[model samples]
Target: MTATGTTLVIGATGTTGSRTAARLMAGGHRVKAASRRATSIPGAEPVLFDWYDPATHAAALDGVDRVYLIPPVGESDPAVVMLPFLHRARTAGVQRAVLLSSSAIPEGGPAVGTVHQALPDLFQQWAVLRPSWFMQNFTDTHAHALSIREDGIIWTATDSGRVGFVDAEDIAAVAVHALTDEHAPNTDLVLTGPEALSYDDVATILTEVTGRPVVHRKLSYEQLRDRLTALVPVEFAAILAGLDRAIAEGAEDRLTDTVQRLIGRPARTLRALCEREMR
Candidate 1:
């Protein structure tokens, strides 16, 4: 990114993307906040963008050199939409791209990981952010919070798997650095918090913060599948449950120093995150 080049954030309304947009503006960099609604963000430019709608792609990419790419939510597959968008962004003269990927999804595997495999060759400079479970999944999102508030029990198949949940703010800070730095990192970063904790640990923290009884109850895969099917399609529900099973197998149970390495501070602790949001 140059001093005068534009930085486009694809999911500007989302938790991490919004923070990334704000950080870019604070650094005196040009930013374009793009979302489906064209919502304006403070200290940045606004533009309409939608992953499902290809027609809005060009206008959003107009005069943009750097991009923060976010895969659309709840769509198990994203390569179909991302591939074309990458080609179009190259044509529109995008020089770098910072993709928000997942820790659970391996590079060149399922979901957005497939998109990660193809991004390097499409742009001049690119970086992939593969952060572990987001801390916002509990506090900022309605689904997890509602479950804790209404049910008094958090249900998942992960019995004792630990996760180093990374704060969205930390993720955003790294993104800002990647987008505006003289040279892009051009590597796949696996980010995590300073400490790893299980869901039971999270429940204990919630119970302490909220002064309410919240229990982490392990559910069988079939039970979780049935519960999710009521809210989403069966296949999608299976995918969600499969993630829990993966976690149970110790898939995302490690801590990483990428956050501190990139942003000069240790990743936010889960206890701090819970106290800030749940309390």
Candidate 2:
């Protein structure tokens, strides 16, 4: 927002948050980059912020009029901590808030969904980003990335289900637009890439681009859940596994023009991501 004051970017070092903060700063906007370690980001004011800690909230909220929210990771339910800080944020003069949510979760569905539902009551200018699964999951230090590096395999419970795997950078562009635009969407925006693709299709593209032997190894819901329990909390593991199951049921099999409509550009493709990250 050109006329607005500083915008506090919660989870500033995280996936979409970091990119959003950078874009804002590049556009000559003030930003308070909120993170757990208060990591330094170029063109941003770093601030120590944690959802579990209330003492860190006040300092981060100082002199900020808007916020970009990235909910706590690995917690099946984040609304408990998020809602309180949001309430405090409203009192501290935050007029607009942009939330990062998932396509699988709707307003009042689960997890950040609760926060999505409460936005109207808290901030007059508020928008929720419900993006499809991120393409970075297959490239970054995520479990899929690690497995791809070690075993040359991509594991998932979604069998034959297609998803509009969006790029985090694209998601951030939409986020920046939502945060800085004159009018907040005041609604949930379901973002996706240009096309829908399945895990098998992803592996095929990876192999073609990177010249690596990557394959999609499909698993049952219970199997994936048990496997993920060793990596994350049991409850979160179940939730992640359940999302994969939903994908199998064609829940994520679609595409949207939100990215194009908001940013005036076609969403990036998984093949492009594979070429950049893998090759």
Candidate 3:
């Protein structure tokens, strides 16, 4: 893609999208940062874009050849709301797409997976990033971080389940490569960190890094669902709980070298990520 062609970043204020936008800007590529509220990034053009609103889609896709897709959050079935916009993007001459999907959600599965499966058919140059559970979940203002800060606890239903939790920064680096490189990986890249770790390991890492008594509190699926329902819809809460259940069943117990292979460096370790974020 030409350096002059604008790369539209959906959910530009989000974890991976924001970092990808920054990386693109640093590389001297044109970036259009799109979100619901027009938030500005230093070297990006901010555009208002909403999934439910088709009017916002054309304006966001205008003069754009590449896009970083961040699926709608908190929605059980995001494809229903996003596919139309993606079609619009293609119609508007967008040639490349990089979708941010989860490790647990396989291609053709519900949610982002549906979009992942559809991308190859929609665009000639496309890549799907299926990253493991994000390390930011424990450091940012997410539920895990909030619980750790407020009560010194990391609660989850994935008892003793180990995951190759990846850093959002690494994910973004790979995403930038996918978006700009001439020979982008035309297949889904399952990204993970250097090691597989459980929540207990994460708690220990947190305690050591922050010098605080952080503990992992494992809850039953029912209890976890109940706790999440207060914050999200019951259906979404159940889906979250179901993911925990899948983890407990050893679904996420694996690691991959995709990040290192693609980015020419090893993936970041959880300890390293915690040490950096804690400071």
Candidate 4:
């Protein structure tokens, strides 16, 4: 199906949102890059938007029918803030939506999961992109990246549990497809890289690529929660630690073809991402 009309890309300055906005613009679709700040993207319109502020919602949704939903960060329950805007969007004739959710958060589970459950009922053309841990976590804003850079250690509570880490770029590609395709996926897409690897395997890859001694420091759930508590709310820290506990139970060990099936190419591998970041 052919794509038409302007697409509002919320969190357009973010990792995946930026890429998706660029791809849509390159494909000849008009894009409105929405963020809390009026961050400009060349060749796309920029608008000030924040989920917590309903006043900013209308102008950003103006003249836009399709939206890429990136939930507000650090909020334990994003649905509370985003649902009202979504209701407004639907009422304003917005037809398609692609939400960036997480693999660990199933529909009706937690966090963005509540929004995932509501998307299908709100819009006939909607997709929830449930991606595994981002490969960029080792090079981006995440704490793991900081530890790797400073102490050459990757700390986690997953022990030997394996995860099919996906790249943010791959997730963006899938999001583009979901947003622009003639018909939306109308369901949740589990996105992951080609292979599953433990934190130890990731450290090994970092060692090989960076020519440094990188190691994985396995911590118990309690230890992990303690480490995170200083940075986030206790409840939120516990939620994050719970994901690691799920990981320990082998929750993220599986792989999926959703990326390749949707984008017609294999997802980027951990080695490739490491090599690129190292250089």
Please list the C-alpha lDDT of all candidates, in the order they appear. Answer: 0.88, 0.93, 0.92, 0.93
- Residues 187-240 of candidate 4 have per-residue lDDT tens digits of 999999999999999999999999999999999999999999999988889999
Error of 2 at 71 (Å): 0.6
**Candidate 3 residue lDDT tens string, 237-274:** 99999999889999999999999998899999989998
Is 1 or 4 the stronger prediction by lDDT? Answer: 4
Where model 3 places Cα greater than 4 Å from the true spot, the runs are: 1-4
Clashing pairs in 1: none
Worst 10 residues of 3 by lDDT: 1-10
Model 1: per-residue Cα lDDT over 201-236, one tens digit each: 999988888899889989988899899998887877
Query: Which stretches of model 2 miss by more than 4 angstroms?
Result: none
User: Which runs of model 4 end up more than 4 angstroms from their true locations?
Assistant: none
TM-score of candidate 3 on Cα atoms, chains taken together: 0.98
TM-scores of the models, in the order given: 0.96, 0.98, 0.98, 0.98
Structure candidate 3, residue pairs in collision: none
lDDT of 2 by residue, 1-279 (tens): 455689999999887888899888988999999999999998899999989999999999999999999999998889899999999999999999999999999999988899899999999999999999999998988899899889999999999999999999999999989888999999999999998999999898888988878999999999999999999999999999999999999999989999999998899999888888788
Return the top candidate by lDDT. Answer: 4
For candidate 4, the lDDT comes to 0.93
Candidate 2, clashing residue pairs?
1-180
Model 3 C-alpha RMSD to native: 1.1
